[model samples]
Target chain A: MSTEANRLPTATLPGGHLDCTGCTHRTDDWKTGPTATFLGLLLFIVYSTAAAFQGEHYMYENYLSPMYSPVVFTQLERTVTTPEGETLKVAIPGAAPVEHAWFGLKPDAWPEWLPFSPAFLILAFPGAFRFTCYYYRKAYYRSFWANPIGCAVGPFRRGLYRGETHLLLFQNLHRYALYFAIVFIGILYYDAYMGFFRHGEFGVGLGSIVLLLNATFLACYTFGCHSFRHLVGGRLNWFSKSPLAHALWKRASFLNERHMFFAWLSLFWVGFTDFFVRATSMGWIPDISTWG
Target chain B: MAERTFEIWRGDRSGGEFKEYTEEVDEGMVVLDMLHRIQARQANDLSIRWNCKAGKCGSCSMEINGMPRLACMTRMNQLPAEGKIKVQPMKTFPLIKDLVTDVSWNYRQNERIRPFKPPAPDSDGKYRFQQADADRVQEFRKCIECFLCQNTCHVLRDHRKQEHFVGPRFMIRVASLEMHPLDTDDRIPDLKNEFGSGWCNITRCCTEVCPESINITDNGIIPMKERVVDRYYDPVARILRAITGGGKKLPTA
Candidate 1:
């Protein structure tokens, strides 16, 4: 040990705490991660919101947009007599023909004020699932809510950090939302199956592949859920006795590890699937099909 | 050898200021190595708390350049080459002296959590379980009581909700016991009220700073939160339990 004379005088801290939030001493460009997350999530929100509002261009041939799957009710296909005395059917370009709708036509009791978009009926279930997702809660909390902005960084809002307890108590409903999402996956898979057939003819098309990939991606995301993982095996006290649940939990854990990747990928693919169906319906892109 | 400057905070509970010291850095030197050099050559009274300098002990946790990191694990090469390194005690905990903190609060939090209560052994006196059962709880056991997750948690660091929230370190402790294959204690009530699991916003700062790379947010905390929901908030689960008379009934205190 050195002599006492070698000791330096104790320095006084300005405040008890270092106030290191947003400190310049941090060498890493920490802002980049949250910024990228913000931009990516914002892009998805904007595009999905616009697509959900667009009532038309959701179906072409036998292919349906994942956004508008299980099409509840649709407008009737219009018909007019040509100059040559031939009756020709006309649909809002790319809109699903009346016969394709599960329910023949838009319900007469539908409130006029509410928009007639099939996407409006179904988006909320999957939306709630993704919104309350354990990974997405982290993503949006940092990127959107600016909860501490980034690790050790100062937050945009300071006082009354209730943190999912008060209004966000709804977030606990994520497990319930998982049930709805599982059902949606089944419906989407059915739509994918329908994509394989155009007017009763079994054939493959670009649209068929798009719908198939959309359903598959959504399935991966839904199955990889944190709550799903818990339900599968986490609730159990003994994995040795429940071999099936143990295996399922292992698979879910594997998928849960990549939940963030699948979350973003599926979000992007869902949007792209809608855009593809819309474009194909509008005749902007021809359906590359074996039928053709 | 290359000369480097370190701005080290030196003070007690009253206050502190960063004092700069220059030292020669060798190849493969960690931040702790440089601090040891400064202690030996310059400030003989320089204070630091460390054990098992290989990063397992987790005693040398400090804020290096504003990020909570283990000094023993933070290699000098990983830091930026140009700037002076800033070293300070963890902000969430009260500073005792220099880099040593009054980490007694963490121990107190650990004390509050109930220990694991497993079922009685079989007739052969063997507590046997499958490797898969052990594997789930094993991930949480890897935690070395680093308190890095606790330090980096915004609920404790920024909001200072220590009275309510048990911080990430203890949350995982509870997760390990709660998810154990044989352990059958019901801490869910305590987790909701006393431990304040809801205070965690799932910002994932704790997960990000974990040296053990434990999936604290996803695998640990969220699962616990879902359990809380099942007991307290989920009407569907409540209805199912009512109809079936089949769910893990909360143990009476």
Candidate 2:
């Protein structure tokens, strides 16, 4: 008897149990359904289409009213001086009382290797496309493709690739990527610091500083990631006796644990910070004070 | 006093579907409690998977009304009685009978991660570790292997990219051990190339659904990604790699 059966006694489910919703007695193996995967494909289609068309309806925004912080949506209108010197009202919002992203004056693309800017977007495309994934193939097959609901493949019982190739011979990119991620975080920190006191006063703003900190944490966590270490040489199957190498690895792993936490906090905070800035610029939140 | 409806799945691998039944309900009952009622008073041989119904073992994860949740912890009162509760197996793994999936593969992946072997201990066999050092790793070990995060992640839940990506849950496991201050194995390269660590776009659905509140992406996945970048893309490191014939010569622990 499997652990599951041992834990459960024979019982009747009239109104039924959640775990037994689609269950039967064939507990030893798994099957698949391409139809379920197709359904998942369909869901993606709907989602992507919605995303494409959701760009902007006149570039207007939803913001809280100064008078009623959480309960109201107020429209922000802004005027900016054009390169030709005439100030005009642009439906798009996002400008502090005296500050602006100056997007109209921004460069289209800097370089293919620059981080977060249009540069990295263009550069990362090749890698992204090359690594088109298969994370939920089993689920899609069962849930959406209308295929038989079961495991696509059984447990592994073979050689290196058959299991997780411990002594990964050619997988070093993950570690390399980590250092650059750290550097990226450092640059973001610099950007935040530059913005922090650039105005000669101790407070150019803490908003950017906070963003920098979030970036810093994400960068640190990403550097400490296991994937990178794996690529670097985590699978050195013959080096079990080497003390120093093992020591660095333990240290890396330690940081990586903290990495997971900061990675998330930063991901969420970045989105929120972006939204907050946009709201403040568009006249949503009046004068976000310079205090920390 | 009240009759509740259950939508149970009634088919096997070849083909099957949801079969509903209505029965009397009770107070302070959980979804698992209802299923037990069904199995005892209704279907005598019905198969369901669970253990430690207190939500500790993670054996009872299922789609409760379209959301990934622990059925044992789901209170019937919290659900809308106006509709039939939809329960399904975790979409990311292979389903066995119904809600049970072939999560055994995850366990195998867990083993693939080099087990923790501390660096040479000081003289004697015993070693000492500071509480501050072990605190964070212990926190990550709280995961019960529920795979709910894997089930709800759009990448694994909708996109079939397992061949190229290991889900956030496994990444969390790797991170947990890697973070152990005394662990003596390197896992970064395997994380990048073999495990397909870069596939996570950080949507963080895994982080969102984690019952343990572990930050799979921020604390685990991104850090791994950053390390990968450091190895291959960082100019100085790349030059060093070229000069040193790759950095694999370094020993772990």
Candidate 3:
């Protein structure tokens, strides 16, 4: 820690001054920015609203809970060679049914004591959103409502905006919250595992299978998350020197680089999984079987 | 020729107005061309910052239609004829004047990024890395520092933490160079605690505003943020990172 401060830039450039070599006069301060914050807010509202209503997020085609859609294989009887002399072929006797691991939200499982678990999940959507965000608090105050164009408006331009530190600092909870997120995945796997063997006696069913897949996709998305990787060991010295640490860092970087894509995809899949489970469990849609 | 109007902002720190300028439009005309014509015929002293109208240099970034963009890259034809086009400076920095903000803060934050400290090479002092390892991070280097992404970023725009959070675009710069396999820098924690790397909410405003089309959120910011989380919070990785000396650790299920 002591060495870090020594090596760090002094935060001041000695003998450095704003010479303004080519320019002339300057006088305006931060307080003069007009209320121009509505521009981004309006656009963001429009986009988020659109994203909400259009909720067809990433969903496994086979996990819709109504039919067992099998993987389509088209290589039953043919092969072709590329100009580069690469031969590729794939053939399956029939559409292979997707196997399940865990995830079952049985009607019987809904004990009265935990009656709100389903509804709670819905509310959790925005809750998860605020907790995991890396930029919203700043954007909300600056561009969402006040003004998108940055011009300070308070007298002396000093008070137009000042960030809140405590709430944001508390946001560090994302590290611990990741534990719950992982546990939820485990719960989902249990549901799927039950669904595979249950022959329809009020046991695990299609809902479990769909939920399991949702969790799997979400895991791919979450484990690859950028924030999660940072808490492990991003800034230490000899502490992170092991070969295992090196391997994990490499893998985390691989996943973290695609954080946005996975984030959005997983978010949508969670919603999709929930809707499928709801429709079937509520009897809004029949739990038909595709396999005899 | 259709006539068009521009609400060109005029004046300096003390005071200014949305001075309107009207110009004749013929065929292919760009925003810079309109400004040139205005400079020739109308307000000669209209102060605007611009350079390399070719779009490679990020010199002319401003809010076009309320979004941060390069004025030189926007075409007069793309805007709706019925509505007005509003142009302003990027949101997060101090305003120097119309469409120009003091971007010096970005460079200041860059100076704070933890200096590179790669593991010592073999006794021979040789390092090896394949092209595949360098390509993704290389994509982030196309940034011209136009500050459009910074302008578009909501964190710096709304949150008054310019002194703390370095915003996503700068994070991308830090992540790209530091993540370079041969480069020996460990910027993960400085990115998290000091630079406020966690402040970004993945809104992707930077990705959208980037003229270079770099995936600011996907490729640069998040990956670095993830590494920061691994080093600081994950128990297993924390133990591993302690032994490794600032390399990096992974996460578990």
Candidate 4:
């Protein structure tokens, strides 16, 4: 069978149809969508990277930054002399003390060359989860990869497109990454719960509310994940017999519809929560609380 | 009543240009109505393919102001109050004449899809799936086959991967069947390889431009991709199937 015979005579317009980026017939402003996505994702990446490496100001009283949740090991509250002979503060203000760390003090095997942050231990799980997300795939593919730039717009690369078939085959592991994400959601909720108690005294603070909302938004995003939707209800062929699965599938479908909304909301709120914790810890903002 | 200008693409596969037509716009005129008036008054030979002018027949699909939309469904009030309403044939397929493209390519693609094959009826000699089961695939049945999704899909529109990808419309068709409780045929291998499911980057232009507002990417294509992953990519699932000698006997391509 001749595949060429199936092809029709394409339009003689400039750039043809596929490469017609500057075609005058296009009346919609196509650049705005991809431009917004590019700037939004770029901002998130930069802010998250700086916050993760800072290692300090991640905790304020009982509130921990979502970036540094499931704190693995913490260093002692003491000043250290740097290689430059400058005094560096090892004790971060408002951070959970070494006693509060799940595994206690930082190990002696810790390399001197590497800067340690609790975020380094756990950020990968959530980061990989988002990177491989079905929604984020669309977001970054259009914005960053310029796969088509916009719906009808021409792409930057003109070569044969492999899409997610080749090197991106690892994207198939998104469901596995989702398991890690679900686990992280549980850890985040625990952190949020810890935020409600300051030194074992039940209390409400601006920081506590911030942490709680962060957990809620992240929960909405994680639960609304496409992979989660498939796992809960999509895999079943017989919804008639499986009443419970059908019910959960319906709920998941509802959230799945708003997955993109929750994705951006959770992303922005997580960054804001980190900033709020950092601000209060650094004495830049006051944490109004019953503990006061 | 108000005067509105339309820049409708005129001509055929040989050549074409946007020919401007100014007409009187009524209170509740749709783009299709304006096109009819223009065809009646100015260019009597002006060509457009439409039926059921109520947007249900899935005809009269064209690029309105650079967005793929059904002309009958797009009201003049919904568009910018000022500016020429640009109307053009769906760019993905070959142009035949003004506002009409050779959409037979879509029909050929449709013919390639395997038809729904439900399992044999029970002892009562009747299908017994609940409404809940039918409701899921019913969303896909809402598709009017406008091929607006095919037009808007960058995989077909920009990348011209029609030889590779089957576009979004057929993906949902396969999803509707695959997710059917009684359907036993397996198209997973074809979905990954021949159908070029991977070609879809999930940019979701198909969902956005869909007149039916189908969640084509999140609900349909992504689920299909996950199934392909389960069959071909998942190592744990493969190991489990190996150890237990348990897995569906997928039909060989």
Interface DockQ of each model = 0.47, 0.07, 0.04, 0.35
Q: What local lDDT does model 2 show for residue A263?
A: 45
> Candidate 3 residues A1-292, lDDT tens each?
0011112122211111011111101122222322232443354345444433322221222333211211111112224478899987643222212233113222444454542222233334344643454544334443443433232221122244333334544554555666666655565565455455444434444655566676676676666644555544333222223445545656866776665456556555655554564455445676664442
Chain B TM-scores across candidates: 0.96, 0.88, 0.88, 0.96
Kindly provide the TM-score of model 1 when superposed on the true structure, using C-alpha atoms: 0.92
Q: List the pairs of residues colliding in candidate 1.
A: A12-B16, A13-B15, A13-B16
- Lowest lDDT sum, 10 consecutive residues, model 2 chain B, at B244-253
| Interface C-alpha root-mean-square deviation, candidates in order | 5.9, 13.1, 16.9, 10.1
Tens-digit lDDT track of model 4 for A197-265: 988999999888888899899888888888888778777777877788778878888888898899999
Ten contiguous residues minimizing lDDT sum, candidate 3 chain B:
B244-253
Residue B212 alpha-carbon offset, candidate 1, angstroms: 1.6
Model 2, TM vs. native: 0.52
DockQ for candidate 2: 0.07
Worst ten-residue run, lDDT, model 3 chain A? A15-24
Q: Please identify which of the two predictions, 2 or 4, would achieve the higher lDDT against the true structure.
A: 4
Best by DockQ: 1
Give the residue spans of candidate 3 off by over 4 A: A1-165, A173-176, A179-183, A186-190, A196-224, A227-285, A290-292, B90-101, B112-127, B192-194, B198-202, B242-253
The root-mean-square deviation over C-alpha atoms between each candidate and the true structure, in angstroms, is: 4.8, 12.8, 16.8, 5.2
Candidate 4 global lDDT: 0.83
Model 2, stretches more than 4 Å misplaced? Answer: A1-292, B240-253
